[model samples]
Target: MEGRNGDAVSLLERYLKDWADESLHAKLAQVFAATNMLQDSLSHYQAALRINPQNEAATADGPKHIETTLSLF
Candidate 1:
């Protein structure tokens, strides 16, 4: 994010307010994940998956949430 992580997240979230596209959710999840917001990231990934099970990114990343959650226990 080149030190603009907050901006990236803010812009993505703003875009999401207008667009319910799975791609947007997937991207936001990616951003959140990069920022160490695992819960938010996982939730967005799940949201993307819900909208489109075929979303490659969501399918690939969403499952990581399970692994992360398990690691916490």
Candidate 2:
């Protein structure tokens, strides 16, 4: 990303278009979080949970991260 000057968000979004897996969504959520795209991150996290209610990471950390992100706004 630093070398190519490419948009990481766009790349992730493109990958999502092809596959909508829970793990992929979780990964996208982390990438979005790293980029400060909180809303998008939260959405992906929620999507992951919707796909698999037992998703431990999303279930445990999603709400906390969402709260933290909203607090910034």
Candidate 3:
């Protein structure tokens, strides 16, 4: 579990190298969200939006996840 978790994080970092691509960014966001890494997910979502404001999935679902995560803080 620990190794898998680390690997996931590493993959996320690698994905970020090409963060300008909305599709790739959204895919990474989904991976983070699936693993319950809400903040990381939100970050990727935001990055996606930054690259392309018209990214519907990032603009809509990103904030929803961010709000849910923030409420926990």
Candidate 4:
């Protein structure tokens, strides 16, 4: 389980490095959030938003996610 989790993380990191597109970044943020990696998730989300302030998903869904993630602290 641990090794699988590590592999998944590595894959996500590679994806982030290779394709920094907003949608992919958002997906990665969600994955990080699901894994309780709030800081990393927030960072990715912020990057996504920065890349596309007019992003439909970010504009429509990001604030809620950010608030929820922040509340986890």
Candidate 5:
């Protein structure tokens, strides 16, 4: 996906529609985090956490993203 974050997001979102995979949501959240789409990233991060609170990626990275997004306001 060579920096094609949009493509990655589209793929993850498409698959997520059929099945709510925690890792997919986590990955999508990271992709959005890398871009300026903070809200989208936060949503996915929350989704992943909702599915599996023990998810290390979401637990670790989600708060950082949320804090960063919140700081923007």
Candidate 6:
């Protein structure tokens, strides 16, 4: 899991450096959420929403991710 998460972060960061878009941010947020990096996920999710308010995936999943993260505490 750790290795997979690290790879996801690395790939996402590399992609983010070349492109900046709501979809990319949303994907990164999803990756982070999968890895239990809730804060980073939330930040990216917010950035995605800020860039495109109509992002259905982010809008639908972001709150669920946050809720799941919060439940861990």
Candidate whose TM-score is highest: 5
Off by over 4 Å in 4: 1-8, 60-65, 68-73
Estimate, for each residue in 1-73, the C-alpha lDDT of model 2 and write its tens digit: 4422236667767887998888778777777777666787888888988999787767776557676869878
Q: Single out the weakest 10-residue window by summed lDDT for candidate 1.
A: 61-70
What are the C-alpha RMSDs, in order, of all predicted structures? 2.2, 2.8, 2.8, 3.0, 2.1, 2.3
lDDT of each: 0.83, 0.75, 0.76, 0.73, 0.85, 0.83
**TM-score for each predicted model, relative to the true structure:** 0.83, 0.72, 0.68, 0.65, 0.84, 0.80
List candidate 5 segments past 4 Å from native. Answer: 1-3
Off by over 4 Å in 1: 1-3, 61-73
Give the per-residue lDDT of model 5 (tens digit) for 1-73.
5469888988998999999989999999899888867888888888898999988889895568577867879
Worst 10-residue lDDT window for candidate 4 reads: 55-64
Scored by lDDT, the top model is 5
TM-score: the better of candidates 3 and 4: 3
What is the Cα-based TM-score of model 4? 0.65
Off by more than 4 A, model 2: 1-8
Comparing 4 with 5 on lDDT, the higher-scoring candidate is 5
**Model 2 pairs in collision:** none
For model 3, what is the alpha-carbon lDDT of residue 72?
A: 83
Instruction: Using lDDT as the measure, name the better of candidate 1 and candidate 2.
Output: 1
Q: Give me the displacement of residue 25 in model 4, in angstroms.
A: 0.8
Q: Which ten residues in a row have the lowest lDDT in candidate 3?
A: 11-20
Ranking, TM-score, top scorer first: 5, 1, 6, 2, 3, 4
> Residue 31 lDDT in model 6?
85
The digit string of per-residue lDDT tens for model 3 on 33-60 reads: 7777788788888888888988988877
lDDT of model 1, residue 31: 82
Residue 26 in model 3: shift from native, Å? 1.0
Candidate 3 has an lDDT of: 0.76
